[model samples]
Target: MTRAPATRELRAEPVGSLSVWQGAALYVGAVLGTGVIALPALACRAAGPASLLAWLGLVLLSVPLAATFAALGARYPDGGGVSTYVRHAFGARAAAVVGWCFYFAVPAGAPAAGTFAGAYVATALGGGRRTVLGTAAVLLILVAVANGFGLRVSGRAQLALAVLLVTLLLTAVVTALPHARLRNLHPFAPHGWSAIGSAAMLLVWSFAGWEAITHLAADFRRPARDLPRATAMAVTVVGVLYLAVAATGVLVLGPADGTSDAPLAELLALGVGGTVHVPAAAAALLLTLGTMNAYFAGAARLGAALGRDGALPAWLDRGGGVGEVPRRSLAVVTGLSGLALAATAVTGVGPQPLVLLTTGSFVTVYALGTAAALRLLPRGGLPHRCAFLALVAVAALLVMTGWYLLWPLVITASALGYLRRRQRRDPGRGVITS
Candidate 1:
């Protein structure tokens, strides 16, 4: 089936194959990634113990933001995700912009995510840059191959990854708590209160994935019945684990929390009282795999949908329908990810910048996605209320994102340009809005 997959017209999945637990696992896998391994330390550097407040604040914001996407996903149940919502609310041109932002951001972010996990592997195995690059290449390829088989395989793999990573995180938190010194809380605002904003910007990387699962919402056995349930489960798990880990890192390691190479590894070692790099590396691998798997699946499907809707090339529309694997679009995503990794390796750019770039794009997506929800959802309903709240929060995030928004802006122009060019070529198939 991987060869061009199946050809079918656009339709809501006849019946989704994913169960509630599986959907929840996919959500967890998408949102809980390498950020847990390094972001707490990075945020602590940006704002000291005050970073905990930043983490908590994001977890709180997640309620409405996640709800907004879940509501849209449940209502639409299409692979186009926010792009589909935007198409319904605004028009084709705007939906294309949303699609391009998300579809392209996956590749830009893949190198960063892969490198994070690879760094852990290198630290554990003593291979350094080569190990990091090799590990990243392998992960990208594995995730691509898995998704090429369709969600049946990738979703289950994500479930397994979620189970493992969640257990490791909880264990690290529980065991490390005894060693946490209350003194760590003393210098909470050491970087000054303004630094909390910086920390929140960095934490946006950790929070970006909440919208990703919307692309796969159609795969749920009963999207309307199961999407919100899965979202709630994922939000609770992600919030608790993130808060627990952030607090544990700050309390146990104090100033060192801001500088640790692998904060989660150090925390686990302190609790377990021995060398834990190997298992820590394993957990990192699972985390990266889960993240890449989810994104590859969602992005591939979204690409096909964009293609099917004439936002992207018709050649890519082969797998836009339900029960079809977007192998062609998957190939495009994988190729772009490899090229992104290569560019970073050659140019000596760091993961941090790539992360900010990714976050910027995702924030732009959330801005438009929430706006689309505000228009598409029933007025005066719970979903509409959540969308309103989410739109407000996303606006704040846009300002915080600063110059990092440049990438998505360029992508926006590119999307619009591509559409205009297509319109000039085929006036019959063009519209300013869908």
Candidate 2:
């Protein structure tokens, strides 16, 4: 033989390098977050003890909602996730707008998650706006850096965080259960049955991340087999934990629960005596960081996929290098988060707009996803039946969100207008970044 070239052993891509248990852990991390910390108080304010019913109702709704996304993930299995499904079911224009809504929502939502944790941290170390702001900034930077390495690193970290969070939550529930008074539940529906709907709107944020988890379906060793199983496991875990915390807020904290932002801290202090501020603050931070990391990781992958697919400007697509991190996408995410945080800190504006925008964007995504499932999934089957129910439920939830829908509407219109202008000038340009 004169001269021969040696073949390179290609490095395997590390996208879907996850087991079922790891997948379940990641789901738990993403789904159980800041909502567990502060939203209970808001729910309690809206429906008193009846907020427990709101929690249960959303969990029940999650059954079909989770199934809808899991089926789509198993069948489609793409990094674009809900956006890819929307593209398949609707068209590119709609998909682009929806994708933009989702990508941008992280910037808005991450700050809210940060503030939930930051408030507790500030209180623990003696309250100050500067402490809250600094704590949140540190949280954002830490999560972004953790995810910048790769999915495997993020997934393992998430699993550990989820375990720690579950342990803390369970400890709180057990410690407080003995102090729970049955009489606290007597005036359950003080706000009336209509209040249940209001509470459900507030509580919807808590039940969000199941759709987000579908982005990582491709990372599972056997996506179709494990995705549904993982989802079911996650739902059970999240539901039990959420119900336990809400019960503690109502039964143990009673009237004070509705007003306290740090309901879990209050419950623990009541049960143990003395300020358990440090432990409470640490728990809140861990809970928020876990959730933030999950979203940052998923959105980074999604942004790269969108860039590669021409849905977004190709300049943003830099994560797919055999076995590398989504650095470009993460930089974009961190930048947006930084700006949003700065604005909020300077303007003294509340995070309600950002929260509403995130909720509305995701709700739109849910509606479209369930609609796609109903259309594409095999008819006369259980999956199809669940999709049908989910579609109806998502539509009703959208209406319940009311004027909040306007935020996503404006975003969609702006996105469409930009795409149209770009197309008019370029004629055949699409968004592939190579």
Candidate 3:
């Protein structure tokens, strides 16, 4: 008698909640936040016109990396995205460390987003410390309130804001093209290729959140097949948008002209020749608000995942019964973020420090995740070889980029401390990988 074909095991029960579009929106909103608006100027400062090339390099590197995560999420569908994947491949303690590192990274992002929002508001209102801090506080509270309601509510708001911001950004880019000068292209690599690589470290951070959606894999209607596509689509759209805006910035304002505090706004002011500060400022305000909203939603989910995995206190894992909010987790996220914002404001350190710290942590996670994928590949299959090669490439980029390897030891030590505490508290508990 012929034997029946072997059945594949399902790792986790499907939550069966979020629609495809909702999933897509979450991916897009998470990736496009404050970084999209801020990076063009920052990259311009670092690499001049050659930053566009860096953006392109990041897009190429990120897509496969995102696909690798999506594949892991589809197979696992666990609470913590990268944490879950690492646990499955490496073991529970390893996963806990990953969770802790990600948890640490998530809160720092708050100050980055808040500061970006505050800066835009400062420009709009003619600048003041109190005004900037107050505006940031108000924006954070608004996003926190919305998140405390439900993911569906926050996701819808994200969709709307993302659409509006993209529309305005595209309009500005297209409108300014006619006024672009050719002289800007004369000295394309003013800072040399090394600057492009360094800036790529920062540029990759802007594109980092595409994998954030993987944390909610259980919510996807058909995660096994659709998650990868959604992730690829989100990364593609955001990458194209970033390139378009960066190209426009370089073309219109030239790399040198747009390197100031409010680069995009400055570019619009110059391009429009003193006739459009109001509209440009208004767009900047909206873009900043959108960024804050996206980060708030994405970061909270990450924290909640960490809590659910027992990397944090269990109280944060309690969802507000059906249709209600994750009030406890929301509080933790908001409180930590608020503390970071206050520290940033008092120390007068701009977003760069936090950006570097968080980005470093994230790249560590990315390198670890890719390494985990290589280990998890089957013994003999064409797909396995392909994945192994991809992971190798990812490893090279992580090394060549060289930011995470430089400063991740501190972050790793902190994560190890957290992991030890968790393990000591419950030695018998098998760390849930999914």
Candidate 4:
């Protein structure tokens, strides 16, 4: 077996400026994103009260997944993130597939996330589909504008939003506990026990960010030591919050939990008792802004990097350099996301399919990343063990993902086709368009 270079073999790597606390904050921001806006309700609908099991399962699963990525990051420490690790473990062909999956996933997924927040706004303002689509459209535009203009939201501001999101969610769960009834637990698996697997697949969106922070691993002051600590802290916080919210939705809202698109807002209304719409919508939108903005910037930059690396068309490669604004890449992402949103609105298919599609892509990335970890990390070590477990888990997730996996499969083919064509043209090193 041609194994990757073990961690101990690499020496004299440069350290970075981020502390444990800062790294943890970044992880929180990355993983605890806009999915929380509506996932509990959606998952509840999928599996009735039993969706809590899926939530808990995903939470528990995140630890090994997070650890696997952290171990990979501490060793390779590249901005290429999963693509870099895949390259080391497999080859450039496989790496390109990972890059395409990730880059294209943002466009496919962003609309769903925006629609999640949009549902909250619609719930608050009473505009129904019009309001929801309008809000989602505005969000997509704002994210593009922010990234295109080089407008940066400070880390402290993002941290504040994360804190506020957690606190608000906890408040809803705690205050609403008084209304929770044991009766709601009855008929737990209304859709059958098999529904639990479906819920687990949908909930993958909630836990998809473990590899995101890997890109910044080199920026951590001590990647080996601090990466795991940050991952652990983020896992604990995100798990507790997700569990509390899902459990509270099941118990407090009962049948309503399976219906409402804006379940968090509903929870706030039930908990706070009267007139929580403004505050709830405001909080949700602010948090969504922070989450989507960061995602847009990151995905745009990744698209640029992929383009520059010949994994994508070179038209996007212009802004891959440090401090350069990836306007072309950003435009493509924004345009694609907008089209996705428009299609969903016209077809009235809602965000569930979008969520599944995005989750499908992430699961593919996770599978490859974990498989890479098994080869990259030292043999007979704890990290390797975690990676093995994570690989098994992700394989199961990819299965649960079912038909949605088709999307990533198509992306994989496109990536390979692009690489093959580019190789034919250059017959050597790849060239750029602009």
Candidate 5:
């Protein structure tokens, strides 16, 4: 077997200490957020009962993707997650491109998610769009504060919220299951398998954040041993929860009724009592908030890691006191997220469009990361062959789900330009490595 270089020998510094459970919580919290709550209704509308097929397809694709990430994390337990993995497997230029893509996706996703959370809160509070905007602002500020303190503090809150969200969702599912009408499943493929595939593309976004935990692999207690287990557990739990909630939404509301905006909330209101709607709305808000916090933590760290590597502004590398927060990077994240919120509010583009715009960029990152896994796999063996084939499949799926690849390409070109400028300033200075 070909052994990879030790993290310490490679001069990779550990930023914080995070146990397996905490890391798992971060992963689950990020992966299960607002998308899980919102997408089932849309998926049902898009594919009818056949949306279940989309869910299953996503699960199958996601498991191997998650496992590939876990294996990469085990081999390269360093910060910057996918970027570092890509750099180790490929080279600095490719890693730089991946870093930019991942970084952009974070802010791109923030506004839509924040808006969704805000909308849920507004409904719960009997307010309007203004209230939703206010809620979004408040959520951004809260997440920034929590993350600025450190991952440990933010991660604990995230874990608690994840548990609460899962419990509430599961309870709602169970209650609604008894009320399921058999007629709801008729005309399973209302549109066609093509539509199901399209819906599956959208649903896959809900599963995107599972790999975020790989960014903090060095922080794990025993990353090589625990990383895979934590990643698998997180993805499996989130997948099961997603399917359960989707089923509950279909069961109680029926295909026609459940196709509306807030299907889960509608189901809870019907299955339990009208009184449950308020709490369900509140749960949705909290779930989105948890996701925002989780992403904030991961994105800031990625920025700091990029800064450390001289791909971004160098000030971001400065660490916080106890929580391992890069204070400068946190500021950047807050500012960018705030800007995104403002832009979305002004333009009136909802979550779907925002998510669609960023999905291509995210898929590109996944493709590159998976390709890196293939390259880094133990050389000259069946393991390498299998890894290469899996990576190829992932790459093909990314291309098949074409939304907008140009955004990622533009961001990468900009990063490359910045890198070139820095290199010219100091010709002999070597690029930072994991």
Candidate 6:
């Protein structure tokens, strides 16, 4: 086996049993989360029709960002993904911080995904916060159960779910386009052109899962060949879908798009001249499930990798294998996610803050990963220039995150502190490679 040089060999799991389409589905499922449902509305609210510019910009930005991570995953093809990249490019301590940030962030995201679906359900039904919170908790638990069966089972399910979600979303977008009015394009920047930055900040969260799916790239049947193709496929699909839906939301609903809770449903309703709540609700559930399932599955594997490295408890490393389920890690992730749901319920904090928190953590991880790509990719080349520009874009997005950046910062500090203590005590556990 060819080993990753100059560092401890990163564990490569037997993940390549999956097909190219499955790999594409993994990327799609990991990324097209519940954010797709409401993010268009939020962006429209922030930047009027000009939010379409934000959408276009992100789609363009995602090309480089997704390509950067795909190159890393193709090169490394390890369960550690970006964590391994950071470990090789920076050091063990930095990798641990990235790992900690990612592991903890998934729990927060679970609730966000659940709440997103629950909110749609609540709107259709007659429930409120409790209903949303309860639904979210149930969804998280269900995802845990589904992932307990392992990746082969979950990955196929995700493929079906992704197909379902994209079909439903595409149906709404295409059907509603005929009703989209040109007049809505006027007064496009009501909030001012600068508001595109704020809108981009909100939408950045939706673009976060590119790195998350890298954790699963090693599972692709042909990681080097299929991984980049899958990334490209997903990027194209997502960009078109996001742009279409966002544009439809603005055109069909006009100013109402921003305030409407269920813009996708609203677009369908406008097109068909009646409410499409049932199908919309079902689509929302699938979208939520796809996201929750992907993250839970990816995080479980990542947790086991962290455990094996002593970044987390060793017990998590036991009972793990490629394609085989990581039960202990699944339990830990599920338990933390349940706790996050409870915290949301108890504190009456809505999903927005949790979304922001998780997004902030992911942004931090992406920044580190992109920086690593800058170092790893050949110098003074197209790939290097792309990584450098991606680094700058991600840095700008992190700055836009503002106080939400606090969560990842605290996690990084805590991780660094822990590693410092461990290194001091052991004196020779593992060397931090540059």
lDDT values of the candidates? 0.89, 0.81, 0.68, 0.79, 0.75, 0.82
Clashing pairs for model 4 are: none
Candidate number with greatest TM-score: 1
Q: Provide the lowest-lDDT 10-residue window in model 4.
A: 3-12
Candidate 5 matches the true fold with a TM-score of: 0.91
Could you estimate the TM-score for every candidate?
A: 0.96, 0.93, 0.88, 0.91, 0.91, 0.94
For 60-159, candidate 3 gives per-residue lDDT tens digits of: 7667677777777787665467776676677666666666666667677767766676676676776677767777777778878887777777767767
Model 5, position 318, has a per-residue lDDT of 83
**For model 3, the run of ten residues with the poorest summed lDDT:** 1-10
Per-residue lDDT for 174-242 in model 6, tens only?
Answer: 888898888989898999999998888888878878888777776777788888898889999988888
User: Looking at model 4, how many pairs of residues clash?
Assistant: 0
- The candidate with the higher lDDT, 1 or 5, is 1
Number of the predicted model whose lDDT against the real structure is largest: 1
Compared with the true structure, the alpha-carbon lDDT of candidate 3 equals 0.68
Candidate 5 C-alpha lDDT tens digits along 1-434: 11343233222344446766777788888888887767887777778888888877777667777878877777777668888877776667778889888887888888877777776667778678887788888888989998877777777887788788888888788877888887878777888877787677677668778667777777666777777788878877888988888776666677654346677677777667767657877787778887888788777878888888877877888872224667788788889888988988898887887777677777888888877767675676554554565567567657657746777878989988988988899766535754
Stronger candidate by TM-score (2 vs 5): 2
Compared with the true structure, model 3 gives a TM-score of 0.88
